[model samples]
Target: MKSREWTDVGTKLFLATLDGLADAELDAPSLLPGWSRRHVVAHVHHNAEALRRLVSWAETGVENRMYANPEQRAAEIEASAVLPAATLRALVTHSADRLAADFDALPAEVWSHKVITAQGRTVLAVEIPWMRAREVAVHAVDLDAGAGFADLPNDLTAALVADAVAKQNTHGNLPGLAAWLTGRTAEAPSLGRWL
Candidate 1:
């Protein structure tokens, strides 16, 4: 599927999960360590805003950092965690809508413009949608709301696995895992507690 289509699918999965949560569930811990479901929702909202800033940078030829620093990003998420369930739900929905609009409004020519990600890698504005798609798809499961990798499109899962293996190769810490994934090894080697 195209990035936009994947983004839509991810958004639907995320929103459906959010919609089903009770107020108490919002305070419950998510699959991600140390993050409650509220934190997960807040992160998703903040991520949309961050990605929008990158798209804005591309369109205007200005440098817009996704966050001032890791501290600021963490503080924002913590601050947002106090929002009521209804408010948090609104934030998730509205931020996603605004991001989709921003992406759709970008001129075709500007899609090739470069912007820096939070990880400090320069990427084309065209890649932002896919970035958001990955965030929503993975975090939907992280929210512990019943969505899983099986619920995502096959193409998206395949793309994410390929991207993960490529990143692991670049990091040089998963040589044996990479060999196993690529069929170079007959049996998957033991890589204890990698995650």
Candidate 2:
């Protein structure tokens, strides 16, 4: 699927997954090591706003960064993760809607404008949608609300696996990576959490 399609599908899937959780479940530990379901939802909300900043920079030639710093990003997530369930849901929904509109409003020519990702990779503005698509789709599963990888769109799953492979491949240990990937190794490498 195209990036736009990925974005739409991911957003719908995420929102649907969120709709399944009761208020009590909001405090449950998420699939992400240290995050609660609330943290996952809040991170998704902040991500939409961050990606929107990249879009804005592309649109106007002004530089609007995703975050001032990594520490600030963490602080924001930690702070917002404690909101009431209903309020958190509404915030995530509104941020996502706002981002989608901004994405739609960007001119075709501006899509080729360069923007630096938080990871410091410079990519075309066109890549923003795919960035968001990955976040929502992956985090939907992280919510642990009966949304599993198998439930994701096939294209996104394929892309995600490929992406994981590419990132993990940077270890420069192809044989080790292959061994772990194929389940040949008794103990998989202690690869850190990515994304």
Candidate 3:
């Protein structure tokens, strides 16, 4: 999808996901082990902001950490998780708006420019938005938020499935990411049995 399209869809998906949750629901654990719904929401919000900052920094011919480190990022999310429910929702709303505006203002030329990664890699600026979309799209389901992978446009889901398939990692888990991503199963199987 185009950058503009991705930004619009991301806004919709994230908001819909947030809207489905009750104040206490945000603390519920998700499909991703050890991550609560709030953690996932904060991760999505932080990632969108981080990616926007990366693109902006690239435009300025400078580089910075996309996140201070995984530990720091986790800390930020955990801290945010304790805010009054309204405050947390407001944070998400504000961050999403900022991300959309930042992306919408980016020039066409910058879309193709390289964004240096915090880990010493680079990806095109346009790719960053796509990554943001993927996070919102997939984790929406991971959190059991109202909108899910099935709610997303088929083209987008298909693309995400393809990406997941290409980057499949077993981690010694049953059924595995490959099977789940390829429509082989809706959820992972019990780890007691592995083929």
Candidate 4:
């Protein structure tokens, strides 16, 4: 599937999970250590807004950073975590809708424009959807709202595993894992819970 299609699937999956949560469930611990479901929702909402900044930068040729700084980003997430469940739900819904609008409005040529990610890596505007897709898919699991890696689409799971292996390779780790991932070896090596 295309990046936008994957992103749409991720968004639907996330919203579906979000809809099933009770008010009290928002305070329940998530898969991410020390984070509640509320925190996961807040982070996902903020991530959408941040990615919108990148899309805007691509459209306008202006430099728009995703966040003022890492500290500011963390602070915003913490502040958002205190919001009520209804407010958090609205935030997630509205932010995702706004980002979809921004993406759809971009000119074709603007997709080639370069933008810097929060991690400081430069990427083209076209990659933003895939980035958002990954965030939503992974964080939906993190929310622990009955979603799991097994619930994700097969293609997305494969893509994520490939991406993880590639990243580990770049960091000079996870050698031989790629071979196992690609079926070059019948026996996969033990790498416990790296994700």
Could you give the candidate ranking by lDDT, starting with the highest?
A: 2, 1, 4, 3
**What C-alpha lDDT, on a 0 to 100 scale, does residue 41 get in candidate 1?**
96
Q: What is the lDDT of candidate 2?
A: 0.89
The 10 consecutive residues of candidate 1 with the worst lDDT sum are 186-195
lDDT of each: 0.89, 0.89, 0.73, 0.88
Q: What is the TM-score of each predicted model, taking all chains together?
A: 0.91, 0.94, 0.82, 0.90
- Which residue window of length 10 is worst by lDDT in model 4? 186-195
Please identify which of the two predictions, 2 or 4, would achieve the higher TM-score against the true structure. 2
Q: Root-mean-square deviation of each candidate, in angstroms?
A: 2.6, 1.5, 4.4, 2.8
- As a whole number from 0 to 100, the lDDT of residue 44 in candidate 3 is 74
Q: Tell me the lDDT of model 1 at 161.
A: 79
Off by over 4 Å in 4: 176-195
Pairs that collide, model 2: none
Clashes of 1: 0
lDDT of 4 at 51: 97
Question: Which 10-residue window in model 3 sums to the lowest lDDT?
Answer: 165-174
For candidate 4, what is the total of clashing residue pairs? Answer: 0
User: In candidate 4, which residue pairs clash?
Assistant: none
lDDT of 4 by residue, 1-195 (tens): 288878988898999998999989999999987888998999999999999999999999899999989997898899999998899999999999999999888888999999999989999999999999998998888888788888888999888888777777666657667677678988876654434
Per-prediction tally of clashes:
0, 0, 0, 0
